[model samples]
Target: MKKFSLLSNRAGALFLAPGAILVALFVIIPFFWVIFVSFTNRTLLGRTAVNPDFVGLQNYLALFNPETFFTRGQFGFSLILTTQFVILSALVGQALLGLLLAWLMQAVPKPLKAFTETCVIAAWILPEVVIGFAWFAFLDYDNGTLNGILRSIGLPGADLLLQQPFWVIVFFNTWRGAAFSMMLFNSAFQSIPPSYFQAADVAGATSFQKFRDIALPLIRGHVVTDLILITMWTFNVFTPFILTHGGPSYRTELLSIYTYRVAFKDFEFGKGAAVGVIIMLINLAFALVYLRIARSRNKEAEQ
Candidate 1:
């Protein structure tokens, strides 16, 4: 029996070895490499390309420098813009709208609920390139579908991308991501006992009252999870580049797009690595908070 157990363990190790090696080569090594590069003056062009010098903290300092910190196209500006984008698109738009939709679906007819879910999920599952181009066509100024409709209705067409690029991406991201939150909240709501809502109904509670007093409390953990996940996803989303290319003078340049522009576009590998490190740290903080909340929830469940 002991010999068989040892053989089984060896077999398991053999099965896992390939995956473990791949992870170390792709994920772990690259992670540390980025950190190391951040402490250098590396670039993809010119002198630094081949003989990059160790300029510890200079890249980070330049990112936070007082002279250019708040300037347009700077790191600080992108950070602030990314913060606003996450708050508006993830926290406010996706979470709130998803909660509302989930609540409404509970009282909706089955067919309507299914149809709504299908439509929302379609938005989520469609290819990003397809969705981006579809939106661009809809929002185009001269010959777009939206402008055509507006002209037909005697309403003036507005140049949304050029005029309100930030809000455009916010709306785009909200529409793109709300399906996940909606589905999560829907599942959370389903986990809730019907008796609680029945009791609320017996007490002549309104829809809003039941949602506020009963549903919300039951799904509080799910809400926290949804918010954290969506915030992180929104923070790192680069799909908006397809829509606006972080353009119209950098109005919609979120941190992800900013990093891409710095690293790949400008070939400033060191500075880009610094920005990547900061983003990683921010995501780490979010992950830590999420784990803490999840652990507490598990403890409560156990108790």
Candidate 2:
């Protein structure tokens, strides 16, 4: 029995070795490399670009020091704007609207449910660039479908994307990603025992009350998971590059776009790596919260 047990353990380790190696080489190594580069004076235009010298915390300090041009307020604005985009578009727009749509599907006829779900899933499955272009055409100022319809109806055509770039990107992101949240909530809501809702209905619970009391409590785990995952993705999203190009006075420039501009466009690799590290730390904080919620939820389930 001991020999068999030892063999089983060895076999399990062998089976997991490849996956562990892959993670280390791809994910873990790159993560630490980025952090290391942040402390260097790397720049594509410099003579030492091929072998950049270490600069301690100069890159990070530059992000905080107002004396440095980049750190003045542009990066701060991008950070704040990115936070707003995550909250408004991913958390409120996608998660809330997805839940509502999922709930609505429950009361709709089967054919309608299928149709609505198909439409949403279709949008979700489309490539990001394709979705961006679709929205680009949809929100185009001149000779676009939306403005054309408005003009036909005697209303003056307006350039929505140009005037409200931030909100336009938010709406676009929500429309593109809401289907994921909807599918997640749909699966979670299904796992919930129907008897809970039946009992709530019998006890004179209003629709909102039932949702607030029963649905929300039962699916709190899913909510946390979805929020964290979506928030991280939305925070790192660069889809606005296609739609807005971080232009019209940089109103919609996200942290990801800022990092790209710094590294690739501006050729300041060290500063870009610093911004990347900051973004990673923010996501790590979110991941910790997610793990805590998941652990507590697991404990509750076990009990």
Candidate 3:
């Protein structure tokens, strides 16, 4: 029996070895490499590219420099913009809209519920390029679907992308990400026993009352999970680049787009790597919070 157990353990290790090696080569190595590069004054089209010097903390210091901190196209500006984007699009828009939709779906007819889910999920699953282009065309001021409709209704068309790029991306991200939150909340609501809601109904509880009291309490864990996940996802989202190109005046430049422009466009590899490290740290914090919440929830469940 001991011999068979040893053989089984060896087989399991063998099965995992390839994947472990791949992760080390790809994920782990690159992670530390980025950290190392951030300490240098590296650029793609410069002498530094050939012989990058370790200018420790200069890249990070430049990002936080007080003179340029609040200026447009600077790291601080992008960080603030990304924070606002995450708050409006993820925490407020996606979480609230998704929760409402999930709650409403609970009382809707089966076919309507299914159709609504399909439509929302379609928005979530569609190719990012296709969705971005479609939205761009729809919102275009001239020869666009939305403009045409507005013109038909005797209303003037507006240049949403150029005029209100930040809001445009906020709305775009909200629409794009709401489906995931909705599905998560829907599952959370499902895990709840129907009898609880039925009891509330017998006690003359209104829909709002039941939702506020019973449903909300029961799904607190899911709500936290959804908020954290969506916040991180929105923070790192680059799809807004397609719609607004972080442009017209850098109005919609989230951290992700700012990083791309810095690293690839400006060819400031070191500064970009610094930005990437900061982003990774922010994401790490979010991940840690999520894990802690999950562990607490698991403990509560076990209790």
List of clashing residue pairs for candidate 2: none
296: Cα error in model 2, Å? 1.4
lDDT by residue (247-276, candidate 3, tens digit) is 878888889999999999999999999999
Question: Local distance difference test, per candidate?
Answer: 0.94, 0.88, 0.94
lDDT of 3 at 110: 100
> Taking the tens digit of each residue's C-alpha lDDT, what string does model 2 give over 143-237?
68899899999999888878889899999999989999999998888898999999988999988888889888888889889989999889899
TM, every model = 0.97, 0.90, 0.96
Better of 2 and 3 by lDDT: 3
- TM-score of candidate 3 versus the correct structure, residues matched by position: 0.96
Ranking by lDDT: 1, 3, 2
lDDT of 1 by residue, 20-59 (tens): 9999999999999999999999999899899999999999
In the predicted model 3, the residue pairs found to clash are none
* Model 1: residue 221 alpha-carbon error in angstroms: 0.7
TM-score (C-alpha, index-matched) for candidate 2: 0.90
Q: Model 2 misses residue 193 by how many Å?
A: 2.2
